[model samples]
Target: MTRLLIKNGAFITMDEEQLQFQGWMAIEGSRIAGLGAGAAPEQEISQASEIMDGKGMLFMPGLVNTHGHAAMSLLRGMADDLALQEWLQNHMWPAEAKFTGDDVYWGSSLAAAEMIKSGTTTFVDMYDHMHRVAEVTEQSGLRASLTRGVIGLCSEEEQKTKLAEAIQFARDWHGAAEGRINVMISPHAPYTCPPDYILKFVEAAHDLDLPMHTHMSETLAEVEQNVRDYGYRPVEHLDRLGMFSRPTLLAHAVHLKDEEIALLAERKVAVSHNPVSNLKLASGVARVPELLQAGVTVSLGTDSAASNNNLDLFQEITMAALLHKGVSGDPTVIPAAEALRMGTVYGARSIGHGGVTGQLKAGLKADFIAISLNKPHFVPYTDYISHLAYTARGSDVAHVWVDGRQLLRHGQLLTLDEERILAEAERCYQRLRG
Candidate 1:
């Protein structure tokens, strides 16, 4: 097995107790073999052909973007400052209709470059043409869970065909790319998918043992529509159809009611909180602290660059930590350490990789990021946890690893051509505009 060692860094594991120290993590093949303070295991260290000196840097589990449309990087900033309906109907959907496999590949590749540089090793993506997105993720050496965003506004036959395509894609690519990629079934949203269609998806997911990803109550307008049409809230309608019983990931759960929150907690539903996207689109803020207190697993996400304007999980983490407190009028709502957990370990849990890839522990996947704390903003590191949550930026990430492979080293992307990807994305965007 190929071995690697990361030594002498201030390690923040984001474990149950939030452990921190200057330590070494040993990687044997794609798994973390051991981690501790001071010295590495001699056998593991000796076997390492590559060593990463982590002095003046903070090593933690890589950020997990729990929800996003990776290919939407091609449409980023195209329809900003608009309501969600207008953004999607008038701008995004029309632009997406022009997307080809090549567009998905190039756009997803660009998104991968941006995410890796920003210290996100794992992301959950919902988009069309995900085969191209999967190929891009494989080539970039990033871990991902991908879903084909299924909108069932068409006929039942067309919906079945798309669902079959999504299922086939999952069967062929789930656990592919050296086990760095997984697959999920995504129903776009309640407004887009009728209850019967969602139930069909739920049954299919149950049959295939795949997780379901979907948007729920992203906006008040959406909630009002659901109420007007279905006579119940979004989550209530989903619960009525028994969609919440499955291993479900709910995105942008902004307008959830108290009863819906309880339902989520009871069903152990996972939520992806996209703070920046919510704020940008004028969507209401998610009750993250309430959800957390309700025993719901709340993870952090950037949604998509098109909606969020950037795929920076660090910024999301900071926003998630501060937004709830300010909105709830409580200073002790979400602590810095807890916010970090939402981005790292909790995110992994949301995507069904809980014990495997979230933390830097033995038997976990060696997927982590290193942020340089030697900068002015990170100076006087009186509290390492505080520095990580508040002081560190995406630019401070000097290294990133996924599945024991070095994808980013010393602020450089090893698997992607940054300039080419960006230029190709720009070209595609111009074509879409034209």
Candidate 2:
């Protein structure tokens, strides 16, 4: 196994202690071997096969996006400034119906390139043609939890086919890509999926023993519709249908009530707060402070480029930190450290990768990024966490590594062909439109 040592770098270890120190970190194979404050020991320096200069760099765990539709990169700005239902039914669904596997591959490739350059090493993607997305994940060297999101609004046979597809995707790809990829069973949302259809997914999840992901309570109208149809709120409706029985990650989770928040905490459910997408679609803000207070794991996500107009998790981090303070009028509600953790460690936990990545600790996957700290936004560096939460942008990411492999170095992608992806993505979009 090759050993690499990086010394004289500032590290934000989002470990159990929330430790930040100027230190040297040792990497063996694909996992972090050791890291500590101050100088590297003589033995480690002598034994290292590669030594990297870490001067003027700030290293931290790569951001984890808990919810997104990666293949929707092609749909960026296609139908923005619309409500969720109109956006999905009239524009998104019709456009997606025309998407072939090749389209998904190119779109996902484009999204992967954007995410890597933006410092997101891990993400949870719920979309169709997931095998293409998985192919992108394998090629891009990004860690991901991929799901075949099924909407049961079609005929009975179509619904079964969709469910079967979702099941087969989970079976075929769960633990692929050297354990960098995992699978989940995802129903599109409560409004799109009937109770019986959702229960089928729940059963399939139990049979496969896989976690589930879904869109839940994203808008107030959806909540009212659930009540009109099922006499229960979205949370109670999903809970009644055995969705909360399995480990699940719910996207948006805006428009949740107090009881719904309590129930989510009791069920140990995780919420992926898509603040930008919610706000863009005129969806109300989630009760994040209350959710955190109730012990629900809250993580950040950019729903999709189509909706958010970008795949920048740094923007999501800043939005999550600032949105809550302004909405609740509590200046100290989500502090810088907490917002940063939500983007990294809490995101890992939400997507069921907590045991392996999300922190710069020994015995964990070497998934992290380095930002050039000499930039003006990072100037004065009084509080690194504050700078990261409030001022940092995705363009500041200078290098990225996942699973001990250098994917981006010196602001250049090492594994992916960014130019080709950009060109092909444009071609794919034109084809879809035509």
Candidate 3:
């Protein structure tokens, strides 16, 4: 087991309560074994096999992307400035049909490079060709929860085949790669999935004890369509089908009624709020304040680089804070500290890794990043929490570590071949254009 020590840093542990600043963190094997403000433990200190200086760095738990189509990095800017339906049907889905396993591998590798450079250590991904995505994630040394996005609008036999594929992927990959990869069953959405199919997926999830990930109420059109077709809103329909009885992570959730919010809280469904994607698509802001007040666990996500234009959780954190405040007309809606939590600890919890990661406490996984604070934007920083949430950018990430393995050091990625990945992605893009 590799033992490493990161010493003399301004630690910003986004723990359950708030940030713990100016501390040292130690990693033994793949877990965090020590973290505190004073001197390192003498016994463990002497036994460390390696030590790295963390001066002029703000160390915090790595950002968790609660929801994303990571391989969609290949389609970024190809379908921008469009509504959700137009973007998906005309651009994203069409291009996705041209994707081969190699395309997925290269595209996902590119996404992983961007993520590691931007300090995202773990991500929850839903897309097609997930085996390729899994391969990329494993090789990149990033932790991930992967799912094959299934559209249940197809024939029953097709649905069964897709479901079986997803189950097999889960069985083969979950807890694999030194416990770095987890898998989930993902039904595309309510509009795409019939009630019977949704019920079937839920049953499968229950049988396998796997958590469910899906899109829900991302736009008013989706909700209105659900009501017109089923005489119930999206959440109401899913709840009636017992979809929320299991551990479920819902993406978007931008248009929900008060009753739907209550139901989400009642069932303890986790929500992944994609503020940047929602804003870019003209989707209305989610009722995050209401959801939080109702006791629902809400986390931040970038959705995909195609719609969000980037995979920076710092931007999502700031947007989540300000969007809710402006939408609700309350200044205290989501404070900076709370916004940071939504991106870190709350995000880990939403993806079902809260107990194992998300904090700098002892016995947790050593998944964290070091932000360079020598920049002009972070000057005269009195409160590290506020500065991090309000001023930090992805470019400010100096180093990133996942499971005690340094994936990025001094803004250079150690796990990916960037030029080769970019060239392969460009070739795929040209093929799509043809």
Residue range 129-178, candidate 2, lDDT tens digits: 89999999999999999999998889999999999999999889999999
Q: Which numbered prediction scores highest in TM-score against the true structure?
A: 2
All candidates' TM-scores?
A: 0.97, 0.99, 0.97
Which residue runs does candidate 2 get wrong by more than 4 Å? none
**Residue-level lDDT for 313 in candidate 1:** 92
Model 3 lDDT vs. the true structure? 0.89
The root-mean-square deviation over C-alpha atoms between each candidate and the true structure, in angstroms, is 1.3, 0.8, 1.3
Q: Rate the local accuracy (lDDT) of all candidates.
A: 0.90, 0.93, 0.89
Ten contiguous residues minimizing lDDT sum, candidate 3: 15-24
Per-residue lDDT tens digits of candidate 1, residues 69-113?
A: 999998887889988999999999988999999999998998999
Query: Candidate 2: TM-score?
Result: 0.99
Q: Write the per-residue lDDT of candidate 3 for residues 1-434, one digit (tens) a residue.
A: 77888888898887655356665778997889888886667775787889887888899999999999988888889988899999988888888888888778878888899889888999999988899999999999999999998998789899999989888888889998999999998899999998888888889889889999999999899989999999999888988888888899999898887888888988989999999999999988998988888999999999889999999888999998888888778999899988988998898999888888888888999999999999988999788888888889899999999998899989988888888888988888788778
